[model samples]
Target: MSDVNATSVRAIATKDFRDAVRSWTFWGLSLLFFLLVGLAAFAIGYFGNADTSTADFLGTVSQVTRLVVPLIALLLGWKSIAGERESGSIKVLLSLPHSRIDVVLGKYLGRATVLSLSLLIGFVIGAVVVAVMLSPPAIADYAGFIAMTILYGIAYLGIAIALSSITKSTTIAGAAMFGVFVLFYVVWNLLNFALQILMNQGYFSGVEVTQTMNGNEMQYERLPDWGLFVQTIDPGVAYANALSVIDAVEAPGFGTAFSAELFPSGVPFYLQNWFSFLILLVWIVVPTAIAIARFDRVDL
Candidate 1:
């Protein structure tokens, strides 16, 4: 592999972004997001309390985006590298001064940027609809939510791009994307249920705790700290739970309802809501880094 030149990476990223923006895929996704957010805003305005805060509105939107953003990002990246390889364009791309690292990194950045732009624009339009139906929402809080949602999409893009880089067939890349969706959305939830069952059956340890809720002493059994960590491993869970970390959303117990009341002593560092950000950052970095290294040594 050649040395990674920032200029080459930027040029490739620019080309990829232009290519994608011109395609139906980009505009189609934009329309989908526009409708999605517009609908969510309409629901809040039409059904929610007269004084619902921006945090409340965004908290609800986060639930939908948690799933939708990953799907869109995965689809965006599923063909990015594999389609190029299959069509023999990768050879032409690499024939330039760009390194394998440049291609992978550039592709990821370009796709991520496309997704970010689509999200920002969609949310802006959605926000207008929100203002019309309800009172104006908090701008800072909404911007922070948008930032988190963009990061969430980028994290999934890293995964899809990494998988695409390892294959020459778009079919395999697509299967990998579906597998990721299953792994996080299905298997992860089942795993949580399994953990709960094991804990209930005394096969796995459960943490016994007491807290005051509604002015009454309450007792509950929670999965152990490690088990709790397992739940946060899902990017969707991390994204929703991590919303509490930002100042824009001031709602209490926002971290998947895992609040200070849940822990009688103190929340473990790994269980802290802010840890979701670290997990997300890892998802973005680890996949791309490994893919770049492997792609560098692979035969194109």
Candidate 2:
């Protein structure tokens, strides 16, 4: 295949975005997203008694970013190529002098951009509203949260786009992709839990435990922080990772523990943050690459 032009990608992206922003499907759902996030920020700000801490904000923000943001991306992406195929537009679009890979990647990127921009705007507004109402988090921390959330959303978009390539029905594509995303969120936890039980029961008997004196008291805990090591394998761990990133310095007053013990063990607090980001990245890239490869072999 010939090189994909920057101009073509941008043109396709712009077209996709315009169509997306104008459609009732996009606006209707996006409006709901804004309202939900707005209400969440409101609840946390007003009724939450400004009892917010960095961890509280981070946790809430992560929930919004990781879950809600991904759902929106899926909504945009699930229908992308599938809807085009169903409407008989894919042939015409594919006939245009562009590689299928470019078309697919450009569309996905465009929709991901829309999701990222919408979420970013909501985050800014929410941050301002919270700041005005209560003591806000540090600017740097909130910024970091936004960056991580955006990356997390991009990963979900990959999943949706890949799923879209699998079917020609928008509804089926949406449902299937949503189901998979839900599975990603839930499965890792089940694995983590099972592994935790087995580990604590000495399934990995080679795993060592050590006794340490924190302050003259002898405490026995598993070495290599096997329990925490288990958590690293879970998606919820990424949510906690994002939370820890935001709450490292100034946590909120929500009675949520910011202690290192509350975090997964075996890694320094900062390393855990990096590790979680990497996990989230893997979560996005692996399936996405598979989808792209699958699409290459299928006749679209």
Candidate 3:
């Protein structure tokens, strides 16, 4: 394989980005995000009391995006390389002066840019609506929320693009996309539940801690720090925790009494919300790195 050429990467990225922007996929995502945010703002304004703040609005939107962004990314990226290969269009792509590394990097950037732009367009529209509906909008919190959401989307895009490059068939790529979805959305959540059950069954030891609630002392078993760390390793969980750290929103159920009991001294650096930012970064980097390495050696 040839060494990475910045000029080649840039040219490929530009071409891919232009092509993606022209597609309905880009506009559909933009519309989807806009509707999701607009509805969230409307619900907050219509149903919430005057005390409902912009942080609350952002929190709600973040939850929605956590589920929606990965799906958008997967759909957008599932066929990036696999579709090209299946249709034999990859020959034209490689006929250019680009290397495989350039193609992989370019594809990842192009698809990620599509998702990012759609997010921006939607958030801008949503911001305007939110500003009018919610007084004293937490612009800082909203900005932080948007930033973290983009990172989260990029992480999934990276995953999707990597998977796309590994296979020659779009059908297999589509299945891989579904597997990615299930791995994160369903299986990851189940792991935490299963761990708790094991601990309850005495299969895994848990830390016992006591706390006073409304002047009544209560004792409960909390997951060990390692277990808590495992729970936060999910990209979606990391995204929420990162938001709490950046926006100071005190994400619901995070760092609560139960959490404090799990870490009496203090949350370890790895398990802290700030560390989740690192976890998100790792998610964005690792999968793509592996894909790039493997794609370079594969028979195209």
Local distance difference test scores for all models: 0.87, 0.66, 0.85
**Candidate 2 has which clashing residue pairs, if any?**
53-252, 54-251, 54-252
Off by over 4 Å in 2: 25-30, 48-55, 135-137, 200-203, 210-230, 233-236, 246-271
TM-score-best of 1 and 2? 1
TM-scores for the candidates? 0.93, 0.78, 0.94
Candidate 1 residue 30 C-alpha distance from true site, Å = 2.0
lDDT of 2: 0.66
Q: How many residue pairs clash per model?
A: 0, 3, 0
What CA root-mean-square deviation does each model show from the true structure? 2.1, 4.4, 1.8
* Rank by TM-score (best first): 3, 1, 2
Q: Once superposed on the true structure, which residue ranges of model 1 sit more than 4 Å away at CA? A: 213-220, 247-254, 259-262
Candidate 1, residues 1-300, lDDT tens digits: the string is 567789988998999999989998778887887888788788888898867777777877777787799999999999999998999999999888888898998998899989999998888888888788776778878888999999999999999999999988999999999999999999999999999999999997798888788889988898888898999988887887778778556444457666687776778888888889999999999999989988998887
Q: Please report how far candidate 2 places residue 288 from its true position, in Å.
A: 3.3
| Local accuracy of candidate 2 as per-residue lDDT tens digits, 196-278 | 67767876642333433465534343424455555664444565565565553333321123244433364454345656777
Better of 1 and 3 by lDDT: 1
Tens digits of lDDT, candidate 3, 182-253: 998899989999999999999979988887778898998978788888888888888878877877353464
